[model samples]
Target chain A: MSVELIILIVVITALIFDFTNGFHDAANAMATCVATGAFKPKMAVLLAAIMNLIGAFLSTNVAKTISGGIVDDQLITPQTVFAALVGAILWNLLTWLFGLPSSSSHAIFGALIGAVLVQAGLIGIHFSTVASKILLPALVAPVVAGVASYLGTKIAYKGKHNLPKESKKRYRNAQRVSSLLVALSHGTSDGQKTMGIITLVLVAGTLQLGGDQMPWWGQAPGTGPHWWVILSAGIAIALGTYSGGWRIMRTMGKGMAEIEPPQGFAAETAGMSCILASSHLGFGLSTTHIVSGAIMGTGLARTPEEVRWNTAKRMLIAWGLTLPAAALVGGLAAWVAHFGSWGFLVVLAVLVIGSVTIKIVSSKNHVSHENVNDSHEVTVLAKAAISSVTETIPNPLAPALPEEIADHPLAASPLRLTGLKPRPKPKVPKKKKTPPKSKKKKQRKAAQQKAAVAKAQEHEAAREKAAKAKAAKEKAAATRAAKAAKAKEVNDA
Target chain B: MPSLIYAIDWMALLLVAAVSIAATVIIAALMSVSNYFFHPPKGEEKASQPRRILGFIFLGLMACVVAFGLYLMIPYFH
Candidate 1:
């Protein structure tokens, strides 16, 4: 392809990746509300779409980071970035198809870093910028979310005890307004990141601009994402939001916890607050982390039992790995592209094929809205498991639950669920006929049988223990009553 | 040097035209009422002042983006 043709193709490819990014992350904004039936899917997306467009008007902070902060544009043109974007886009599509909530932000970052590393060697890598901005936020956001949700749930349910009926109604109404504000805030903040990237591409194309030199940004703040750039980014994202990433919605909305309307509101509000604050300061905070954290926080607040630690562990692992992985990929792409056009083509093909393979592998379990609110899976360790299982005894005569069952949570199984943990994966020794899986399966079966026997044994033991405790408690009460009666008789006499 | 800026005038004009056309097309399509006779709503969802304020915010945003883009594209003070 001619240089002009190659550059044009690359630009289109970048926009395509941006579009995919839009769809990939839509659930970060609307999943909770949609999951809770705050709005119909269509309405939720429409609301998100319009607000995102409006949000594009708010700030240009994230855009600046994309266009200027990550890689030197002078060293690479729109074409090189285009190759990086292609890598990101492929990763996004594959992840979306399989319902993995892998970060698009990370994918783009990785692709850019990998390409840059390959091109300019280690010199191109801006480890500090990536760390301070992307890395810190990605790791911290979710932990913050988990803590916040834990606290928020604890407070809302506990605090409501003293309130009158009218006051509770008022709180519910307040949630509605707060939820909308969060949606608007998300649109403003995240929509800007894409804008900054597009602006970088445009500025890099011209001879007027030097390699990696940002004289304009030095002169002014919010000068990076040009006006048209904002419009395109907003429109693209809005359209993507309208299309929706349904698979991701299932993962974000239902996979994390049993999201009640109030909790959903709380999570979204927390996410919006974090996102808006970062956007204003020109920080390219990951909306994914913010939203994920918010959900985890709300989970903590309501019922720490329902927070799926196993699933969360995998997500955490992905979070930890995404930056270095993406950086490597981007660096590699940069290296290949440094050989000129042929290298770009080769990198692009590898990305497409590899992502497709990953998609095929990871899509064994597909999360959907139909099963989102169903009973907690064993794979997920939601605090709500106790409530769900205790309710499922089938016999009304089993036992009376304590008043604070949601608070004091107990697991029905002997396995002792501690909420979302990463499933222990066995490593392959590169030998033929691995028997570990079946061994693991047989082990699981034995464990299940043992659990059943243990349950029976524990049940009888528990009954005997409870019977004795009850007798003692009743006897003490009876003695107190008898003493009171005797004292009354003596006084009357 | 002067000719370089002048030569880019056409490219700049074309770029601006493409952008303006997109914006105008979007506005015209959304604001048009010609089809209302065929498919009238029981109640049209009206955008209130606050909503309009929000809409204007985007417009103001569009203006800022275009201004900044022009600033970048323009070659001055050689």
Candidate 2:
């Protein structure tokens, strides 16, 4: 195929990746809210989709990073980027197919790296930029998210406990605002990464700015892949969001946390803070990392047992491998593509054929809207079913068991939660090994324990921390009150 | 100086990095999964250290691979 046709094919493939990203990661923004019944599936995605569109206009820094920050677009060709994209897309598809929560950011980065190596060797790598922009955030962003969520959850609990029923209603009701902000923030942050890459392709191919001048369109393209590119990428991601990566959603929404509205709201708010900060700074921090870590952190804060360590570990592995894997495949593809236009055609044909086969096969094995919102227990069972179908689902302990996820029930192209094995169901009961004591005794003991702990800490710092903790307590108490009132009102009538 | 030795070593480093990156990810995933069956009753202390180490290894290997990959890809310009 000609270079023009080659670019077209590559962009389409990128869209395919984006589409997978949409359904695969939709849960990142909407899963908690969806799990909590804050919004119906349709309403949740619709809201997420619209905000994602609006978020496109947020900033162009991430776009710049992709197009210019990661690699020197000038040293390579549009074809090189195309090769990198294919590697990225393939990695995305493979991860999604396996249901591994791999990172698109990493995949793209990897593929770009790979393609650059094959096409032009390694003349234009920026170590400082890579470290400052990518590595630092990769490590810290998630941890920060987790910390913020843990704190957020503590506050949520105290608020639930102490706030008068009337005022606590305000925060619960304001979830709409926070949830939508997350979608908008997610869009603003994620949309720009694609823009940056495409623009990088344009600048590297068109302008001969000897590595010194980073030529950004700074404006939408009037003719080529311009504003339409921005609009399309946003819409693509939004549509992905709308499609709802429900499998990952279940893992995040229910598996990680028994999120009340307060915790969910706080997690979203904290996630928004991270995304907005990163977008403004123009770094390509993984939205997946920030949101999931925050949710897990909040869950951990709620109760240490609440955060599912197994699933979280699986995600960390995916994030770690995504960029390098993409880069590797990208490099391989570039090497393969070196065989003239025929090389590109063969690769393109393979991708088109392979993607179509997956779609057809996946359609047959879908989780469906009816079962999508089934309780977390049912979702785990659904995953268990997929694993049994594909004996490839390894004992998560086996070094390679990460790839056993045959179907991701939550997100689209974003695959994760791969380690599935025979549950030590018997052992699960062993953790609470105590024989069932009287319910009243357990409740009283729990309260007394909480009170005793509260009393022991009288220092001012502890007091302020307790003060923050008190808000979540009140919120939790209010929710309990609402549950009680609803029950009582039924009895009175 | 950006010596010839610097150039060739980076390429070799990339291959080592790739192998390590793949192994580290697979190893980390397995160990965590092993949590359920082998040591089904791990405390926070048990889980946290292995997890941190695994994560640290993954990041370390990835960074090394990227650094070296960039190193090799750099000399193709002139």
Best by lDDT: 2
Task: Quote the positional error of residue A182 for candidate 2 in Å.
Answer: 1.6
Off by over 4 Å in 1: A58-74, A159-173, A208-228, A281-284, A346-493, B1-78
Q: State residue A228's C-alpha deviation in candidate 2, in Å.
A: 3.0
Error of 2 at A9 (Å): 2.1
* Model 2, runs deviating above 4 Å: A57-67, A159-171, A199-225, A281-284, A360-365, A375-493, B1-78
- Give the distance in Å from residue A415's predicted Cα in candidate 1 to where it truly belongs: 26
User: Model 1, range B1-78, lDDT digits (tens) per residue?
Assistant: 453334232343333323323332232222222112222234744445555555455445534533443333222311
lDDT of 1 by residue, A296-386 (tens): 7777666668778876776677677666666666666667766766876786678668767755653344333343344333222223333
| Cα lDDT, all candidates | 0.59, 0.61
In candidate 1, how many Å is residue A309 off?
A: 0.9
Q: What is the DockQ of each candidate?
A: 0.02, 0.02
lDDT over C-alpha atoms for residue B31 of model 1: 20
